[model samples]
Target: MSTFPDYYALLGVSKTATTDEIRQAYKKESLRTHPDRLTKATVEERKVATEKFQAVADAYYVLSDPSRRSEYDILYRTKAGNKSSDPGSSQNFFSQFANMFAGASTGAGTGAGPHGAMPGHQPDANGVFADVFEELLRPEVERVVPWWSYLGAACGAGLGFIIANIPGVMVGAYAGNRLGAIRDAKGKSVAVVFLSLGGSQKAAILRALALKVLGSAGM
Candidate 1:
């Protein structure tokens, strides 16, 4: 059996909570646990807060997405009464997601220095690029691509017919179909990773990337 987070508990919401309620709970929890709110705290305290914030963000991300939430609900129901006796079960689950974020954070903080020491806190280009790519492609990776694939083939054929003739149209359709199938397969692979994640971790990355994407668009 795959392990999963109790997102509802993480967000301090009941299973029956409405979307708005969940959003409210997330906002409250996020603010309360945000690392910035612990400026005076010791390093360990701040670390704990950061982890809590990530978990809250992860919970919100899953619970807010209707389809993902539905999948989670099914799994949650299946595991509902089967409480583990191990005290570390929840911590283990959170750590799986946290480790991903922690690595990203560490890389970003340390920057691209060979010794993990940079003069200023420069952004790690590779780490940032990887996170951005993962977050941006996540939705596409979750999308159903069959209809889009057919559409791509049709569009390709039409364009080819205009440019060349029947031969071009046939070539274009084949190329487009292959491209679509490639994308579909890529999405399936990413979807498998999503399931392996136990249904969390993209939201914090999305939030970070959204600022960059939206900032560029505005400028």
Candidate 2:
């Protein structure tokens, strides 16, 4: 089992809160904890306020992202015993996955029939699995290249131009771009795995496996 910060509680929102609701809660909490508002307070008060402000910002950062929020919800449910007590075990985790798949299928087939299938229709297990897998793997928000990458490229090119002119400029630009791309890829992969696994003791092993898979696929 793993313990995680209660981000929802930190933002003063419920687990089922809508995105707009969460945004509003974050705005309220952030304003209350903003360090500038405590300028005349004691040193200790300012320090505490700063910490709370950062925590609120962190809570908003995680909760505002759909993909990360989904992952957090899984861990939250596990921690709250909404899921099985020992979700860290491979067997238990797979069982939960299967249950989720089944539930999805059931929900999709609602009002179809007592047998949970539409008239003259057979459920496509493979198709359903593929959809679920795709959803799990997809990032809810597409990320743009980091601003620092452009800055790095400009700096590298300038330095190279100063040293060796034309050919050096090309080489420097390529190196900078390659480095940035690699760093970005690794960062995204790690973020996905960390949020999905929730940093549990057993989850470390799973995270390693996930990273290996992503790496092998050149993610």
Candidate 3:
């Protein structure tokens, strides 16, 4: 008998959920179940996390596509319809689809759910990389902070550099001590060294700081 997976329940979203809501839930769930997050876990734990991650990815791939989602809904309703009727029927629509899917995969199913395989023949070696790339490219509303916040930090760093460069102070001591202070408080220092020179050198420092902030935020 063919089995119809509950795509909505698997995604932890209601049947009536909006597209954006489904996408958000999928991102949150996938990140939580991602295998990379369980590096220190036991073997069994890693196995389970992989399965769960694939399931969430499968759910998102279907629900995010308008045509596939409509087709899935139809199958979902038909299965529901079957359950409410007599159980003596010789065959069901889903069972046929399931059989066809098995034949297509030639019994070596992708770990993704029955319907979740990408279109065409994807070489196994590249599947995981493709999935990660797609996830990163998907736009979402969540961000650690606005772009302007990083800009402000860069500005603050520049202003501090100017104030520390008063004519009487030795440039090396001022830059080294300021860097040490940053290191002591944060337990790490920015990799790029900033010089106290008041011209293009200062511009380079500010640019480095801005890039550092953006990198820290995973932009």
Clashing pairs in 1: none
Choose the strongest candidate by TM-score. 3
lDDT of 2 by residue, 1-219 (tens): 433467787778888888778766765565555554443579988777656665565455446556546765776676664332121232333334323323222333121223222322332222221222233333421223344466667777877788889888987877776666566556554234323432242233323333443332111
List per-candidate RMSD values in Å: 16.2, 16.8, 15.6
- Where model 2 places Cα greater than 4 Å from the true spot, the runs are 1-3, 81-219
Candidate 1: which stretches are off by over 4 Å?
Answer: 1-3, 81-219
Q: Using lDDT as the measure, name the better of candidate 1 and candidate 3.
A: 1
Question: What's the lDDT for residue 8 in model 1?
Answer: 83
Instruction: Estimate TM-scores for all models.
Output: 0.39, 0.37, 0.43
Q: Lowest lDDT 10-mer window, candidate 1? A: 108-117
Which residue pairs collide, candidate 2? none
Q: Of the candidates numbered 1 and 3, which has the greater TM-score value?
A: 3
lDDT of each: 0.52, 0.48, 0.45
- Model 3 is weakest, by summed lDDT over 10 consecutive residues, at 187-196
Q: Give lDDT: candidate 2, residue 193.
A: 32
What ranking emerges by lDDT with the best candidate at the front? Answer: 1, 2, 3
Top candidate by lDDT: 1
